[model samples]
Target: MSKIRKKKIKKTNILLGFICILLAVLLGFILVTSYKSEQKESRHLSEIADDQQSGIEDYEAVKERAKELEEISSEEAEDTEDTKDTEKTDTADTEDADKTEDTKDKTTAASGIVCWGDDLINGEESNTYSYMTVLQKLLTDNGYNMTVINKTLQGGGTLSMMKMAGVSDETIQSYITKHQQAANGAQLNVTETGIRDLTEEQTTRNDMDCIPVIFMGYYGGWNHDPAELADQQEQILNTFQNKNQFIVVGTRPMDGSVTSEALDQVLSQKWGEHYISLADVTAQPSSTYEAQQAMAEAILQKLQELNYISKN
Candidate 1:
């Protein structure tokens, strides 16, 4: 009876020990599974944080690039504006210069003939009445209105006769007879008028008003002494001054027979470069068409330099 009881108790103890071992094994498995799940969750949280950080960096970089682009656009706009302003300023300056030139030309034209000279060159021969005719042609070619007064007198080159207020009886008789013959008695009742009876001032004024007046005459040569040439120049200047007109004097060349260095010297001293000698003025054949063309060209050049035309 004692052996059986002892055997049963031993078996019971062993069974209880086996049960405790099984429970311990189950608890260990549960703890390991829970630990692994928690580790996975932590890793996921770390990955999410890293992604957020990358996104923030990208956003900041984009903002910086946008600011840079804005600055570039603003600078481009300013450059465009500056370019336009410069162009406008240049245009204004050009216009101002053109206006100034126009004003100067108008003033000169309104002042009448400020300067005049004889033949542009020395040692030149010209028809007395045709001198102004050539000048008129030249002026007209150069876009100026030019008409010449036709006057017939004994000395075509001298202004003395034209300036004189008195005429001889013989000259008056000759004029009347010539007119009577030209009429051929067709107008027998035609009245005979004496030159002395004519109004000098009124006739002179009428002649001056009839055509374009040019102060051109032959002087300063063997025909006239230095004193005479100087006197003539002075007289013409004085006369034209009173009338407010331009005068032209013809000078003899130093190389010509009547070459008086004195006249040139005086002219150079008093007139500066305004005087022109017949030699230079009529170097080309005086009677030739080519000479006429050359003379016209020279005069046109002078007018252009004096700002007579619109500036290019």
Candidate 2:
């Protein structure tokens, strides 16, 4: 082997080694570039996945909010319905109450005679000659209604007669209890108290639509002066007029004294059609049953004349 040949072989081996190194470096660079590109692609894909997840969460949240809104609207509708139903019930109750009040008013109007006077008007054991019984039967037969209130006392005069007119029985009893004579001989001035009480009662009677029929002079007992009796009668008429009440004046049948006749004349003159003459109706000994019936008929005729009842 020659030295020159050996050296050439050595140089060739070195050159081949250098070429191999260059090829290895190029392969490493290609691998590194591919790995970097893959890493970048993976990062972009991860970001896209995150964005998709966020979008899904937002959509779910929107659906949940819509469901909440639907629930709120449904509750509001239910509340509105309940409010309307309550209003309807309240309106119905008000209508019913108004109807009830109207019915009560009608019933009150249908009942008759707010006030009346005399001992005959008081309740007692019935006899055929009883004035109240006969009058009641006559009025009922004529299709007329009568509500009588008796305010009679043993010694009651014209002033004390029917003093509690239009007042309830309980109230009249209470008033009587207060005005009764004392054990020490102190007695209430019956006439003055009666006038005052009657004035007060007139105010109440004015509100009730009914007639006030008064039978006077039984308690006068021929004691009261004729002129004074006339003046008192005039006062009564004026008071009733002031209260807007129409009065029906009548005389007692049994007490046919001069004073009674004079008072009847004055009442006839003053009251005209409102005056009822018991003497003209029935004769003085009217305690008989037939006389009482005749008296009731006469009174009924007078009421018919006044147009308080239909003539038919």
Candidate 3:
């Protein structure tokens, strides 16, 4: 009887130890699975956070862009008024006006540089007010008869818009590459979709055929691929045939989005002598008008070097 009892007790002890071991193994497996699941969830949450941050940045950009557009519109209204006044004066003073018109016609018939750009170069807001005025001053001062046609204060700078307006794919591609490389091998954040808009809008203008050179510049709010940009540059060069006659001047990430690389590369290629760093423009940190004058001086110097002025 004693032996039987001892054997039963031993059996019970063995059974309990086996049960404990099984439970421990099951518990470890559950813990590991739970830990893995938690890790996956954490990673997913991190991605969501990153996307949210990007969305916020894009939202801010859009808002800023809207503000810029409103300002530009007001300035444009003022310009229209000024233009109307000038037209009235010209009509009243026909003799003098005719002489001026004739001279301008003659100059156009002779030779001149046609300049153009997107909002960064032609915005209506105070922050962007001086681009054209500065450019015009530079051209006139340097003796080049210049005609500027500003298009698309809001939606005129994308590649798709350019294609719709008749700018060649080759031209668009060339512009992108040139801009990216000009920005110094830095990955241009501009997307391919909007790349051709500015070109198309510019080409569609009635004045497009008249301008010899296209001046294109932009700031932030878009992503332009560097590889695509280089290809576009090559295409433009091939299409234009005459660099001296149909030169394309471009400044990338014009809204302070791009580093100096884009500007540096562009200047090094076509308008190296003509290139002026934004620093030069804002040397004294003066009013928008004063800074524009400074920019004008640099551009004027380039025009002079180009021999646009008559010797008369």
TM-score (all chains, Cα) for each model: 0.37, 0.43, 0.41
Question: Which scores higher on lDDT, 1 or 3?
Answer: 3
lDDT by residue (tens digit), candidate 3, 154-242: 42344543443455768666656666656677665454324433444345545433333333335332244433433333333333323
Question: What value does the lDDT take at residue 47 in candidate 2?
Answer: 97
lDDT of 2 by residue, 29-104 (tens): 9999999999999999999999999999999999999999999999999999999999999999999999777754
Q: Which of the two candidates, 2 or 3, achieves a greater lDDT against the reference? A: 2
What C-alpha lDDT, on a 0 to 100 scale, does residue 122 get in candidate 2? 27
> What lDDT would each prediction earn against the true structure?
0.48, 0.56, 0.53
Tens digits of per-residue lDDT for model 1, 1-312: 699999999999999889888888888888898899889988998999999998999999999999999999999999999998999999999999997876665534432222223333323334432444465566666566534443323222323332331333454355456546665765432222222223454235323222112223332111334444444455434443233222233445333434535556665565443344434666554435555455545544554554443322
Over all chains combined, what TM-score does candidate 1 have? 0.37
Model 3, runs deviating above 4 Å: 1-111, 121-129, 137-146, 151-165, 169-191, 195-214, 220-242, 246-257, 261-263, 266-271, 274-276, 279-291
lDDT of 2 at 283: 63
Score candidate 2 by lDDT: 0.56
Off by over 4 Å in 2: 1-110, 120-128, 151-155, 162-208, 221-223, 230-249, 252-260, 286-288, 310-312
